[model samples]
Structures are given as structure tokens and as C-alpha cells.
Target chain A: MKNILIYLRLGLRNLLLYPMRTGLTVIGLGIGIAALTFLSAMNDGWLQNMKLNFVLTQMGHVQIHAQGFEQSRRISDYMGDTTLVDEALQSMQSMQGGIQAWSHRIRVSGLASAAGANASVLVSGIEPEREKDVSRLHTFMQQGTWLQPGDKRGVVLGDVLADRLSVGLGDKVVLMAASPDGDIASEVFRVRGLIHSGVMDVDNLLALIPLKMAQHWLHLGAGVTDVVIRTNSFAVVDSVVSNLQQRLSGKPLEILRWQEIDPMAEQWTMFAEIYTWVVLLVVIIVVLAEVLNTMLMSMHDRVREFGLMAALGTTQQQLFAMVVYETLVLVFIGGILGFLLGGAVSLYYGEYGLDLSQYATAFSFMYMSSVVYPELTFNGCARILVAAMLGAVLAGLYPAWKASRLNPAQAMREI
Target chain B: MSDHVLLEAGGLCKYYHSGGSDVAALDQVDFQLEKGAFTVLSGRSGSGKTTLLNMVGLLDTPDMGSLHIAGENVLALSLSERANFRLQRIGFVFQAYNLIRVLSARENIAYVLQLRGMKKTERLAIADHWLFEVGLDGLGNRRPDQLSGGQQQRVAVARALASKPALVLADEPTANLDSVHGESLMSLMRDLNDRCGMTFLIASHDPVAMAAAQQCVYMQDGRIVSVATP
Candidate 1:
């Protein structure tokens, strides 16, 4: 350890003498690390944001929709076994380490009118009491109160939709839609509450209604779209879905998870992996070139010095070990500095996401929400640091070998 | 003592390939130096004096010969073993100082001891002792470039002998020094030889080197012409 440290000090001293070279190398490496961190954070944030509709806020781990229902939007396309719903919920409760909460939802698209203005909206009819246990909509209510058993023909409007229609809490709205038989039916509902979801589409075009009222109005009594199941961890989603599928195999039910519901989320996950690999490859190349260049030049300039060491009885292995040790030291220091710098930038951005609101209107982009926040994990930074250090040591190998291979006699004659 | 023969070479020959022709640098030669002897290999340019010194120092291998330093045959050993033998048994001083410009005088001398795996305290103590021996005791902290020619040479000598190797191989030690420093260095070597019983084999064509040696072996055309006992 002492011997290695001695050599490492020597290598560091040599590098330090040329501040510009070392600084440029560090900047190159730091940029690589920053790119990786930023890209990864963006990918992670995008996936997490998308899953807000299905994973964290809506679909717990698994969702069971009526078979063939996703293929067609018509009410007659429903193929769910309500008899199995009770059995499945019972079995899930009885099984060891099974589902945490389970509930059902009904979705319909129709026109809603308030005061003389009308607009199309996507309405979700949920069992408010049971739905609160599965999703956080009850708390998401921005004003007034969520559905109660006594409040019949009542609905909630998204804040943006209310704004577009110039309405507020405790207002009356009329909903128009066709029943399963193609007969037009219109119902007037009291806008009991308003919700703000932060998502533009959801806030502008979404409404929540009672499930019983939906089934009755749609003329599909005792029927629901699907049962949504929430588990303790997302990891158990696949196994739970498979287990539920096998348990209820004979029925015409299809189990779906967040990954299946939104493949864009899966693509976002892969983006993180690809981003990390690309950044790591870049970082490795940069640090490798840096250490290699420094060691090569140092060896070339100090040919006589190496020859002197060789003549003094320092073995080839010793010389090589010394060079490698020096590289490792430099790598360790550089990696740490780079990590700290990258971490500082990540933390700053994570706290205050990069606001591109100035270009928001110019770019014709609205999908991205306010500011882009980066997510950082300690484990990832540590892994990159270790990899950087290893790259430094590996980079020093060829030059160290070349230096140790020098012919002592000829080197001495050059003096 | 047979075990203390310090350096031994037999049937050593060195050939270099240049321009599609074989040039004999050192013909077959048999030589040995016992402990405490100051021996010089004196020759004109291209007379294989440096080649012979290199072979004895284990810096180069002879084409067809056996070399034994400190009782072990060098030809039979591996590359790493040869290197270790050289580090443990040989000290090398060159005409050009060869001190690492980045390191101070003390560090340069102590570096060899470090390579020999000595602790810093012991190595520094030895470095100080050798610096004092070379009459540059307080100048240990100065870099090579900061020192004059004689001071740098003294530091190089101190570095070479700091580890107290079994033999010292010097290649034209005075070639870069003026007569005053050259004489002072020779006198230092002579004093070290008599007082500490150190063995030295100097490879030089300089008259000063030839005259200062206790024994001289003259070489011509890669062959030894005569051995003179002073």
C-alpha cells in the first residue's frame, strides 16, 4: 500500500504540473457524467409521470378489464364475470401476501352542459368509498366534497373544464349520451366538486361520476369495465396477475399490469439503460485517453529515468505496478471530483427543474409539464465512480508495459 | 569468499544486427571481480566496454554466456528474477547523472531503497548517510536541475550506493564532469572502496578513469588486449 501510494503521488504530481491538461480532461469526463445523469433523470421522470395515470395513482399493480372490451368501445363488447369478482376478491384477501386493495371502475365518453355551453368529456364512474382505498381521488378533490351514497346524480368536473365553461362548485350540469339500445338519454347532474390533476388533458376533459349511476344510465346494470388491484410493491404485480389469471382461468377475464397498459412507460425504462451505457462508454473512453496520454508522455520524457530505475534493481513487475498504482490514484481523485460536480448539478436541477417555459409556446409542445426534474440515486453514482477508477487503471497498462520493456544499456548510452 | 565473488562473466558475447549485417559488440570474454576491488574496463569507442558492463549488471543478456552475480547464474533466471537480482545486488551510476528532475536529491537516492522495499524512515536515513558521504549532506532537498554538475554527480553516486548493493557498475562516470569534480568523485570512490570494501567495475575510455583504477583491463576490437595491475 505504501509503495503504491508513493508511485501514485508521483503520477499525480506530474499531472498537476499541467493544470490545463488535467482540467480539460476532467471537464470532458464531467460532461459525460452530466449527460448520463440528466438523460437518465429525464427518462425516469417521464416514465414516472406517465405511470401517474396507471401505476401510482390509478392501477396499483394489476388491472382486470373485461375481455375483448379493450378491442371495442361499445357496451355490448363487455365480457366480465361478476360472479368471479367476489371469489377473486375473497381469494386475494385469504392468500398469503396477496393484493392490498381491489376495486372496479366504469368509463364513458359523452357531452356535458352547464348554463348553455356544452363540451365533450371522458367520465370515470368509480365506487367512491372503495375507490378512495385504491386511489387518492378523494384527497385530490380541489373543492367541495367527493361522491357520497346519498348524493345521487352528482358529478365532479376537472378544474380546467370548469374554467372553460366558466363554472364553479355547486353548479348544475346536464350530461347527454346514448344508452346501449341507441336511445338518447339526458340527465342533469349537480357539479358537487372540482379536481385539479396537473395533467393538461385530464384537467381539461375528465369527470368523475358514481359507478351505479353510470351502469344505470348506460343501461348496463350489474356490469363494470374491470377490477383494479393494488399491491404492496410493483414487483409483485406480475406474479399476482399470473396467479389471479390461473385461479380464474376458466372465466373470460384478462389481466393487465401498468407495463401492459402503457408500453410507453416500458420504452422510457429502456431509454435509461441505453443512456447509461452510452454515457459510460463515453466516460470510459475519455478517462482512458487522458491517463494513457499522460503516462505515455511521462514515460517517453523520462526514458533515462526509467532506465535508471531498471538499472537500480527495480523489477519489471515493480515498475509496472508503480505506473498502474499512479493511474488508479488519479482516477479515484478525478472520479470523485466529477461525481461531486455532477451531483451538485443534479441536486440543483432536481430541486428546481429546468424551466423551458420560454420555448413552451414556440416549440408547440404541451406534453411536458412544468419544469423537468432529474432523479438521482446514490447507487448509480457509486457504480459510475467505480467504473471510472477501473478505466483509469486499465488505461495505464500498455504504457506501463512499454516503459518496463525499455533496454537499460541503450537508455544509459543516450545520457 | 566464493559466495562473495560479486560479479562473474564467462564466454560472454554480444552481437547487434544493423543494416542486414551482424556487428560483434563484445566477443567471448571471461571475467570476475571479487568483493572490495576497484576494477576498470578501459577501451576506445566501440570496444564493447559498455556491453560488458551491461551484461555484468544484468541490464543486458549475452548471446552465449553464463553470468553469475552474488552466487546465482543470471542466464538461468527469468526476466523478473534478473531484475530483482540487479535491484538487490547492483548499483548503477551513469555519466549523465540520470537523476529524476522531479524528485529532490534525497528522494532520488531514497527511491532505489524504496524499490528495494525499504521503509521510508530507513531509506531516508540511508539517503542522508550517503549524501553526507558524497559531501552533500544538507543539499538533499534540492532537485537535480538546481544542483551544479559536481553536486548532481555526487547525488547520483549517493543514489547508486544508498542501498549498499554488492557491486557498482559505472559507465563513464566522469565523461560529463570537469577535472576538479572528476578527481573529487574518483577520490570519493577510492575512499568508499578502501573504507567500506565496496566493489566497483567502471566502463570508460577516459584517461582519468584508467589512471584512477586499482586494476585496468584494456579492450580492442571486442577482445581484451591486456590486464594491468596498479
Candidate 2:
């Protein structure tokens, strides 16, 4: 170990001799690492935001969607009895460390209009008291208040939709939907609240109403889309789902997690994987190329020197170790610099977040809801460092092997 | 002295295959050197002097040869064993004075000693002693680039001697130095030969080196023409 350290020091000293070249090569590696870290952080942030908006906002930690409801979105997916929901809620409440809150969601599509504007909206009818504890929609409201029990004609308008219709506070809106009899029934609703979630799709199209009122208006009583359960922790979603399935066996009910409910979460995860691989490949190529070029040049310049070492009782193994030591030195110094630069950028963006306010309209589709915050996990950082070192070691191989295989007599005789 | 042959070679031949034809670099040759003898091999370029030195030093394996160094047959040893034998029994000085450019004169001398697994204190003491022996007492801290050609050559000589090996093979050790420094280095090698009983084999084409050796072997083409005892 000590001899290796000595040789490593010698290698480092030799690298320091060419300051400009060393600095440039390190900067190149730094740029590559920066690309990887920055993109990784952005991908993580997007997934987290999606989980917050689409999944956790209403579905809770786990959801028990009746089979085929996720694909078809029809009322036929509702299974068992409505009384079973009460028993399940009671069972969840009585269990120790199992679940925190539970609620049933009913989704309906209708045309909502003011005096001059009409747009299609997705109406979610939820239990007031249970939904508050389950999904925390109370924090999302910007104006008015939540629906009360037994309220038959109350509705909440998303902030963007309310803004487009020039209605707020106590403005009345018309909700028109087709009844089960295939007849269109229209009802005038008093806007009870305004919800301003920065997500453009949700804010422009989603509305929350009382469950009983939704049932009465759509002529489908006791019809729910799915049952969402909130657990104390999200990490145990799969375990809870498994236990729920085992307990509710022989009943055709299928429990779905967030990743199951929203196929986009899985897509986001695959995107993160592809993005990380691309960054790794590009960075490895650039770093390895620079290091290989430098090492080959340095070795070729010291042909006669290597010959002398070979002649002076230094074995081929020791000579190869010397070359490896040199490459490791380059990697160590360059990786440190790259890590510092990349980490500085990541931390800075992670803390302050990147503001896309100017291009907010342009990013409406990609859902730049708020500021873009960079996210970093411990695992991602470790992977970057290990990858950098591995690239460095591999870059040293070709040159070191060549130097070790050279004939001492012929090498010394070369001009 | 007859009972202890420091070096021996029998039927040593090295063939070089270049392009399409085979050129014999060294024909079948037999030679020996007694302990503490200063032996010199002299020839023009491509005359096999350096090839003979390399084969004897175990830097290159010879085809069709039986070689013995300090009573051990070299042909029967493994690669690592041969390396170990070279580390323990041989020291080498080159024409370019191949001291590691990043290291100081003292560190260069102590390098092989460290390879020999000597302790730091002992290596240092021996390194300083040999630096002083080669008339570079306080200059041990200077790198090779910081010194002149003669000083670098002296540092190289000090490094080779610091290991206390049984044989020191020098390939034109004074090739880059002036006549005065060359004569002084030759005298230093001779004095070490007398005091420490370390065998010396030097390969050079210089007239000064031919006159300085106790036995001079002259080569022509790829074979030895004559061996003169002076």
C-alpha cells in the first residue's frame, strides 16, 4: 500500500508538470459529470411532482380500484356492496399501523358553463370530512369553502377555469350531464370554492363536488369509481396492497398503487433510466477519450525512460503498476474537480430551484407547474463517483499494457 | 576464485526476425567472468555488444543458451523468479542516466532499495552513503533535470551501487558526459570493483572504456573477434 502511494505521488507530480493540459482535461470531465447530475436531478423532480399532483393529491398512498375501472372508467367496475365500503373503512380504522384514512371517489364528465364560456370538465365527487384527511384538498382551495354534507347543488371550480369564465366567490355555474336514461339534465350550481393547483390540466378541467349531490345529478347513486386508502407511510404501499388483497380474497376486488393508477409514473421512471444511461455513456466516452489521449502521449514520450526502468531490475509488473498509478492520479484529480463543480451546480439548483416563469405558457404541456427543483438521492451521487473512477481506471489500461510489453533493448535504442 | 564464477554463458545466440529474414544478433558464444573483475565489451553499433549485455542481465531471454549468475542456472527459473534474481543480484546503469526525472537524486538511489523491501531508515542511510561515494554528497535532493549530464550520470551510478548487487552492468555509462567526467566515472567504477568485490560488465564503443577495463572483448558483425587481457 505504501509503495503504491509513493508511486501515485510520483504520478501526480508528473501530471502537475503540464498545467494547461491537466486543467483542460479535468474541465471536460467536469462538464460531463455536470450534465449527468443536472439531468438526473431534473428527472427525479418531475417524478416527485407527478406523484404529488396525480397520485397523492387524491388517490392517497394506495387505491383499491375495482378491476377494469382503470382501463375502461365505467361504473360496471364497482363491485361488492356499498355497505362493504363502510366495513372496509372501519376495518382500516381499527387496524394497528395499517392505514390512516380512506375515501371513495366518483368521477363524471360534464359541460360546465358561465354566461359566455363552456368547456368540458372532469368532476370528482368526494366525501368532505374523509377526503380532507385522505387527500388534503383543503390546502389546495384558494377561494370560498369546501362542500358540506347533504349539500345537493354545490361545486368547486379550478382557478384557471374560474378565471377564464370571469367567475369567483359566489358565482353560479351550470353543470350539464346525461342521466342513465340517456336524457341530458342541467343543474345550476353555486361555486362553493376555487382550487388553484399550478398543474394546468387539473386546474383547467377538474372540479370537486359532494358525493350525494354528484349521485343525485348524474342519477347514479352509491356508484363510486374507486376506493383510495391513505397509509401512514408510502414505502409500504406494496405490502399494504398485498395484505389487502389477501384479506379481501375471493372478492373480485383488485387494489392498485400509484404507479398502477397512473401509467405515466412508469413512463417517467423509464424515462429517468434512459436519461441516466445516455448521460453516463456520453460522459464516459468524453472522459475516457481525454484520459486515454493524455496517457498514450505521456507513455510515448517516456519510451526511453521505461526502457531504463526495465533494465534497472524493475519487473514488467512494476512498470505496469507505474503506468496505472499515473492514470489513477489523473482520474483522482479530475474526478475531484468534476465532482466539486457538478455538485456545486446541483446543490445550487436543488436549493433555489430553476424559475420558468417567463416560459410558463410555452411549457404548459410539459407541466412546468411551479419552479423546477433539482432532486438528488444518495444512490445517484454514489453512482456518479464510482462511474468516474471506473472510467479512469479503464482509460489507463491500454497505455499501461503497451508500456509493460515493450522490449527494453529496442525501446532504449529508439530515437 | 576458480570455485566462484560470478558470471557464465554457453552457446548464447539471439536471432532477430525483421521484415521477412532472420538476422543473427548474437552467434553461439561462450564467456565467463571471475568475481570482482572489470570486464568490458566493445563494438560499433549493431555489433551485439548491447544485446550481449541485455541477455546477461536477464532483461532479455536468450535462445539456445545456458546462463548462470552466482551459481544459479537462469534458464530453469520462472519469470518472477528471474525478476527477483535480477533485483537481488544485478544493478544497471544506462547511457541516458535513467534516473526518474520526478525524484531527487537520493530518492532515485533509494527506489531499488525500497523494491528490495528494505526499511526506510536503512534505505536512506545507504542512499546517502552511496551518493557521497559517487562525489554527490549534498546534491542528493536535486532532480535529474536540475543537474548536468555528469552529475546525473553520477547519480545513476550511485543508485546502481546503493543496491549492493553482485554485478553491475553499465551500457555506455559515460556516453553523454565529457572526457574528464568519463575518466572520473571509470575510475570510480574501478575503485568500487576493488573495494567491494562487485563484478563490473560495461558495454561501450569508447576508446577510453577499452583501455580502462581489466578484460576487453571486441565484437565484429554479430560475433566476438577477440578477448584481450590487459
Candidate 3:
């Protein structure tokens, strides 16, 4: 440790003497690290947004179903006694990260016809009061009103779905689908609200109606097709699913987490994370080059000094260790400055959010909101820091080896 | 196990690959120095004086030579062993006064002791003793560039002898100094030699340094021409 400190002192003194070169090298490395941190924060924020608005709101954390419903997804495969199942799920809250909300849903593929136009859509039968607790459907209502318990024939239509069908709130529409017992069913419903969730799929093909009304229309007889659940955190989804499966065993129920229910959501999260790592990988590579160049430049400049040390009883290995020390000092300092600059930018945007309203049209962006808040997590920051530190050490190796390889006599002959 | 000689070098041969042909830097040179003798290898430019210093310092290996320093045959030692030999047993002062410019005079002298795995307090104390011995007492805190040529040379000498090596090789120790500093630098080395019985083999073209030496080895065309006791 003492020798390391001395090597660091020597490195610091050398860098101080060549301030401009060291400053420029540091700035180069700093820019690379800052770019990585900023991009990582952006990726993390996007992932959070998806989990919050898309996954939790639409898929929920876990979805419990009748045994065959996961395969067929048919209205006929409805589960009975949803409240009993929900109560049972709540018993083991330790593994669930605590369930936030759960809503019984009866979803069916149907056709909507209104104003002499027709379009295919998924009709959701939900208890308005309970749905509001679990999903963003109520909040996304852009027109009219959410369903109230007493309104038997009331319905909510996605704005784009309604547009395609040439219908609006207050307009009457006909919904047709297959009944549970294999009968053709049709119902006349008055649209109560127009919802535009800003998600292409949700906006183009979804409609909501009262649970009792759907139960009557589909002849479900006090049964729900699925029970969508929300938890406090998505990280415990796997454990929650396992616990729910174990608890709901022997009841002909197939409990599924959001990752299994909506595989694309899981895939998208991984994709976002991988994309950020690839970008950081490139940035780290460039930073490594900068560090290596700085070390090599210093070695070239100090041949005589190195030789002098060699002749003065300092071994080649000690000189190589000095190179390592020099590189670590340079990289750590640059990494710190980089994180500060990058963190400042990320934190500012994280607070105020980055309004991508202008770029929204140009960029085919994902998630529901145009504004994005970048996230800076300790885990994420630590990963980048570790990568930067390792890259710096790797960069130092070649230059250090070259320094140690120098001939003391020949090097001493240099100016 | 050998005689009382501090350095025994025989059949030394060195060649440099120049533009085309190899030029002999040392031609079968045989040299020996007894313990505590102050000697100089005096030669003009290209006379291989620096080459001989580098060879004796173990900074370079001769194409053919058998070297024994402090009774150990080091010519057959590996590269790392040669480095260890330099570290533990030999000290060198460059013609350019190659004091590490970044380190203070105290640090420069102490660094040699540091390499020998000496304790910090002991190393600095020994450094201070050498500093005062070589007439650089209070000026130990100054960096090489901050000191004059003479002072830098004094610090270099202090650094070399700090290890108390079996032999010290100084290449043109007075080549960069004027008459006054040159005489002072040579006189300081002589004084250190006389007081501590330290062995010194200095390579120089400067008459001041040559005059201060008790024995002079003259080199011409990579071979020793004469040995003078003055």
C-alpha cells in the first residue's frame, strides 16, 4: 500500500507537469463514461416506464386463470369463485412483494358494429371500481365517463377503435361474440367513454363494459376468465407466481406472471437492457483506447527517466507497477468526473423529465408518454464503474509490459 | 569466493550493429578494481567509456565476458538476476545527472534505499546522512531541475552511495558541469571515498575528475591503452 501510494505520487507529479496532455486524455475518457451513464439511465427509465404504464396496467404482475384458458383463451374456460382465489392469493404475501391490486376480468374477442362500420376488438368485462384499482383504463378515458355499477348497458371504446367503427361516446353499438355454450350472442350497448391509451394495440382494439353486463351477455353465470393482479414490485414476480401456483394447486387454475402472460414485455425489457450495454461496451472500448494512449505517450516521454530508475536500483517490475498505478489514477479520476457530469444531466432530466414531444413524430418511440424520466440506479452506476475500472486496468497492461520490456542501457542512451 | 577485488571483469567484448557492420564497443577488455580504490576510465567521445560503465553497472551484458562482483559470478545470471544484482549490490550515476526530475533530492537518495526494501525512517535517515555527506544537507527537499548542475550531480552521488554498494559506476560525472562545480563534485566523491573507503569507477573526459582519481585507465578504440597512478 505504501509503495502504491508512492507510485501514485510519482504518477500525479508526472501528470501535473504535463497538465494539457493529461487534461485532454481525462476529458476524452470522461466523455466516453458520461455518454455511457446517460444512455444507461435513459434505458433504465424506459424499462421502468414500461413496467409502470404498460405491464402493470395491462398485463398486471400476475394473471391467474382456469387450467385450459392459458392455451385456448376462450370465454367458455371461465373460472368460478374469483373472490375465493384472490383471498387465497393474499394469504402468502411474503413472496408477492405484497399484492397492490387484483381485478377479475372476462375478456372475449368480438366484433363491434356502429354507424354502418365494423371492426374486430377485444371486449373486457370488468367491475369499474375494482378495475380502476388495478389498471390505467379508467385514467385513460379521454371522453365521457367510466362505468358506474348501476349502468348495465354502458361501454367504453378505445378512441381509435371507435374511430374505425365511425362511433363515439353516447353512440349505440352492437357487440357480437360466441357464448360459452357455443351459441351466437349479440348485445346493444351505449358507449360511455372513449379511451386513447397512446399504445397502438390498446388504442386500436379494446373496449370495456360492466362485469355483470358481460356475464349476462356471455352466459358466464357468475364466472371470470382471468384474475389480473398487481404487486408492489415487478422483481418478485417469479416468486409470486410460484407461491400462487402452489397455493392455487388442485383448483384447476394456471397462475401466470406478466412475463409468461406477455412474453413480449419481458423480451422488450431485456432488449432495452442489452441495447444499453452494447452502447456502453462501445464507449468503454473507446475509453480503454484513450487510457492506453495516455500511458503509452507517457512511457515514450519518460524512457530516460525509466532507465535512470532502473540503473538506480529500481527493477522493471516496480516500473511496471508504477504504470498500473498511473493508469488507475487517470481512469478513476476521469470516471468520477464523467459520472458527475453524466449524473447531473440524468438527475436533472429524471426530476423534470425529458420532453421528447418534438422528436416523437420523427422517432417511432415506445411507451405511453412522450416525456421520459431517466433513472440512475446504484446497481446500474456500479456496473458501469466496474466496467470502466476493468477496462482501464486492461488498457494499462500492454503499456506497462512495454515499459518493463525496455532495455535499460538503450533507454538510458535516449534523450 | 574470490580475492579482495570489488569488481573482476575479464574477456569483455561488445558490439553495436550500426548502419551495416558491427562496431566493437569493448574488445576483450580485462579489468579489475581492488576494494576502496577510486578509479576513472578516461576517454574521448566514441572511445567506449560509457559502454564500459554500463557493462560494469550491469545495465548491459557483454557479448563475451565473465564478471564477478563481491565474489559472485554474475555473467551467467539471468536477466532478472542481473537486475537483482544491480538493485542489491551496484549503484550508477549518469553523465546527465539522471536524478529523477519529479522526486526531491531527499526522495532521489531515499528511493535507492526504498528499492532495497529499507524502512521509510531508516531510508530517509540514511538519505539525510548521504545528503549532508555530499554537501546537500538542507537542499534535500529541492527537485533536480530546481537545483544547479553541481547540486544535481551531488544528489546523484548521494543516491548512488546511499545503498553502500560494493562498487559505484559514474559515467562522465562531470561532463555537464563547469570547472568550479566539476572540481567540487570530483572532490566530494574523493572525500566520500576517503572517509568511507567506498569503491568508485568513474568514466569521464573531464580533467578535473581524472585528476581527482587515484588511478586512471585510458581507453582508445575500445581497448585500454594505459593505466596511470597520479
Native interface contact recovery, model 2 = 0.41
Q: What is the interface RMSD of candidate 2, in Å?
A: 1.7
Residue pairs clashing in model 1 are A313-B87
Ranking by TM-score: 3, 2, 1
Compared with the true structure, what per-residue lDDT tens digits does model 2 show for residues A254-357?
77887787676667667768877776666667668879998898888788878777766677787788888888778777777766776777778889987867
lDDT of each: 0.76, 0.79, 0.85
Candidate 3 residues A117-159, lDDT tens each? 9999899999899888788888888999999999999999888
Worst 10 residues of 1 chain B by lDDT: B1-10
Per-residue CA lDDT of model 1 for B1-230, tens digit only, reads 28667777888888999999988888888887888889889989889888888888888888987787777777898888888787777788888847877789999999878877889899999999999999997999998888998898888888878878888888888889998889888888878888878799998877777778999999887888899986
Q: Give the range where candidate 2 chain B is weakest over 10 consecutive residues by summed lDDT.
A: B1-10
Model 2, B1-230: lDDT tens digits are: 25578988988899999999988899987888888889999989899998899898888888788898888898788766777787898988888847888889998999889888889899999999998999999998998989999888888888888888999999998888899989999989889888888999999988788778999998877788899987
Better of 1 and 3 by DockQ: 3
Residue A260, model 2: lDDT of 81
For model 1, the stretches where C-alpha displacement exceeds 4 angstroms are A30-57, A61-103, A107-123, A128-208, A217-223, A229-257, A357-368, A413-415, B1-4
TM-score of chain B of 3: 0.96
Ranking by lDDT: 3, 2, 1
> Of the candidates numbered 2 and 3, which has the greater lDDT value?
3
